[model samples]
Target chain A: MERKTLDLWVGLFVVAGLAAVLVLAMKVGNLSTFNMSESYELKADFGNIGGLKARAPVKSAGVVVGRVTNISFDNASYRARVTMVVDKRYQFPKDTFAKILTAGLLGEQYIGLDPGGDEVNLKSGDNIAKTEPAMVLESLISKFMFDKAADGDAKK
Target chain B: MLERAITGIRGTGHRVVNGVWRLGYASRFFLAVLLHSSMSFRRFHLTIKEIYFSGVLSLIIILVSGLFVGMVLGLQGYETLQKYGSESALGTLVALSLVRELGPVLAALLFASRAGSAITAEIGLMKATEQISAMEMMAVDPIARVVAPRFWAGVISMPLLAAMFSATGVFGGYLIGVVLIGVDEGQFWSQMQAAVDFRQDVMNGVIKSCVFGVAITAIALFEGYDAPPTAEGVSHATTRTVVTSALAVLALDFILTAFMFRGL
Candidate 1:
C-alpha cells in the first residue's frame, strides 16, 4: 500500500508537472488568439516574408499592440498578403503606414505601424492603405557580390 | 631539436589533411546509412513496445535532470538579463532557450550517455554470445528485426523525452523566477508569452532532437555490431559508443545550427 501510494504520488507529480508546463507554454507562447478588447483586421502586401511568421508582433511606433495572424499570397498580383489584428482600443488612422520590420540584427520580423494624422479612423475591417513589403537580406548580399563581380570584370 | 620541430609541423599538417579525408569518408558512410530507411507495421509495433520500455521508463531520470537544469539555466539567465535591465526578457530567454536548444540537447545527451551505452553493450553482448547469429540462422533478418526496431524506438522516444525535458525545465525556471527571484507571476508569464514563438525555436529544438535521436541510435548500433570479440572489447566498445556519440551530438549540433541559420 505504501509503495502504491508512492507510485500514485509520483504519477500525480508527473501530471502536475505537465500541466504546469502546458499552462506556462500557453502563457509564454501567447496562445491566446483573441482576447482583451476587440480586434481590427488589416492587410499588407509583401514581396517577401523575411523572418515574419504567424503571430509575429504588430507594433505602432515601436510599441507592439497587435500581431500578424495569417499569410496568404495572391498569384494574380505576385504579392504576399498578410492579415494582421490590432487591439481595438488603439485606433488606426486612414494614412497609417504599415511596415513589416525585423527585430534586432537577427530577430524575427514584426509589423510596425507608423500612425498617421488623418482625421478618418479605420473601421473594424478597413485595410491600411499604405504598406511596405519585407526586405531580403540575402538578396542584398547577393546583389553586392554580383556588383563586385561586375566591377572585377570591368577592370579586366 | 629545430629539425625535429620542423618535421613535427609537417607531420601535423599531414595529420590534419588525413583527418579531413577521413571525415569525408565517414560522411559518405553516414549518407549511405540514411538511405535504406523504411518502417513496416510489424516493425512499428515492436518499436513502440521497445520505446515504451527504453524511453518512457526513463522519464524519472529526465525529470530529475530537467528540474535542476531549468533552475540553473533560469538563475543564470535571469542574472545576466537583469544586468541589462531587460529583466522581463528572462521569461523569453528562459522559455526560448529551453524549448529551442538547451533542454533537448542536454536531455538527449544525458539519455544518450545512460540509455545509449546500455543499448550498445546489450547488443554487443548478444553479438558476442552468438545470440544474434542464432537469430540469423533461425531466418530472422537481424538488421530488420533487431536493429531497425531499436533505431525506430530511439527516433520516436527521444523527441517525447526532449519535450518532457523542455516543459519540466521551464516549470523549474518559473519556480526560480517567481518564488525565488520575486518576479510577479503575471508579469513573468505575460512577458514569456509575448516574447516566445512556437514556430521559430520550438521547431528547431524538436527537429534537432529527432536528428540527435538518429545519430545516437546509429552510432550505438554501429559500435555494437562492430564490437571486437572479447570481454575487454565489449567494455571498450561501450566507452567508445558513449564518447563518440556525445562528441557527434555536439559536432552535429554546430553543423546543423550553421546550416539552419545560414538560410535564415
Candidate 2:
C-alpha cells in the first residue's frame, strides 16, 4: 500500500475506535443519564433498607431526581441511615416521605419520595423524618398466616 | 529398570529448568522493549503502520463476531426472560455481558490468533533469514528498530478493538431485540443505560482490554525472538504464541476481574 493510503486507513481506524467508545459511554452506558447540575444531599432513616444499594435511583413522582450515595447503619437509632444526592431543580417539602420500593416483582430496589404539603421546603443536609422501610416478604407472609389462624379461632 | 527410572527423572528436571530459564528471559525481553520504546514514539509513522496492520486489518472479524454474539444473547435472553414477563431487560443482559466479560476476552483471543501469530511468524522469519543479525552488523539495534514499534502498536490497538467489539455487539442485540422481535425500543436503551454504569463497568472493561493487549504482544514478541533459526522452529514459535497468549489472557482476566468487580 502507498504511504498516504496507509496513513488514511490508520486514521480512519483510530476515528472509528474513538467513536465506538464515545457511543458506549453516551448511549449504552450511564454517562448521559448523569446530572451535572448542582445537587444537594438529604438523609433518611429506615428500619430496613433491604437490597437498596448505593447508586440506586431516587425517584419522585415516577421520575428519577437523585441517587443513593450512602447506606449505613446508625448504632444509636438502630436504623439504616440512607444519604441521597438530589438535584437542586427539584425541591421537596419538609415533610417528604421516603420509602424503599422495588420496580418489578424480582427487580432491584430504589428509593421513592412522596412529597408532603408543608410551608417550608427541605434544605441540603436536612433529614427526612417520615420514611417507610422495605416490605419484607417473610414478615408479610407470617402476618398473613397469623391473621388467618386468628380468624379460624374466632369462627370456632 | 532403576537406570531407566533415573533417566526419566533427569529428563523431567531438565525440562523444568528450561521452562524457568525461558520465563526469566521473557521478562528481560519485556523490560528491553519498554526501554527501547523511545524510537517507536520518535518515529510515530512506524507505529502507525503497525496499527494499520494489526488493528485495521482485524476490524472485519471483530465486528462480525460481535454482532453474532449479541444477536445470540438477545434471542436466548428473551427466551428465558419471557418466562418471568421481564423481556424488556434484554438490553441489560446483552449490554452487561458484552461490556463486562465477552468483549475484552473474545477480542483478545481472536487478536492472539490473527495478529499475534502473524507477528511471531514475521519476527521468527526475520531472525531465520539473518535480517536481525544484518541490522546488528550495521551497528543498528534490532530491538529498537524492529521490535518496539510492533509492541507499542499492539498495546494501542487492543483497547480500540475491544471497544469496537462491545459497541458492535450492543447494536446487534438491539437489532434482534427491538427491530426484529418488536420489543419496546425505549425500554431497551433506557434499561441498558440504567444498568451499565460508565465508571464501574465501562472503564473497568477498558482497563481489562489494555492489560490483555500488553500480555498478548509481549508473549508474541518473546516467542519470536527466542525461536531457533529454522522453518520448523518459526512455525512452532507461531503456534506457541497463540497458545501462550490465549492462556495468559484468560488467567490475567480472572485475576483482574477478582480485583475489579469483587465485593460490588
Candidates' TM-scores?
A: 0.67, 0.93
Spell out the clash pairs found in candidate 1: A28-B193
Candidate 1: TM-score, chain B only: 0.85
Q: In model 2, what are the clashing residue pairs, if there are any?
A: none
lDDT of 1 by residue, B1-264 (tens): 999999999999999998798557655544544443354234455565556555766788998888888899789988897776666666777888888778768877987877789888988999999988999999876766677667777876777778788888888888898889987777677667776655555657778888999889888877787687679888998998889888988898888788755533
Tens-digit lDDT track of model 2 for A1-156 = 898999999999999998988989999997887763579999999999988998888999988888888889999989999999999899999999999999988887999999999989999999999999998888989999999999999999
**Per-residue accuracy of model 2 over B1-264 as CA lDDT, tens digit each:** 999999999999999999999999999999999999999999999999999989999999999999999999999999998899998899999999999999999999999999999999999999999999999999989899989999999999999999999999999999999999988999999989878878778889999999999999999999999999999999999999999999999999999999988745
Each prediction's DockQ against the real complex = 0.16, 0.78
State the lDDT of candidate 1 residue by residue for A1-156, as single tens digits.
Answer: 254554454455446535544554465565553343577888878777766877778987777688787888899989888888888878878998888787665555888889889999887667777888777888879999999999999999
Q: Judge candidate 2 at residue A77 and give its lDDT.
A: 88
Range of the 10 consecutive residues with the lowest summed lDDT in candidate 1 chain A: A1-10
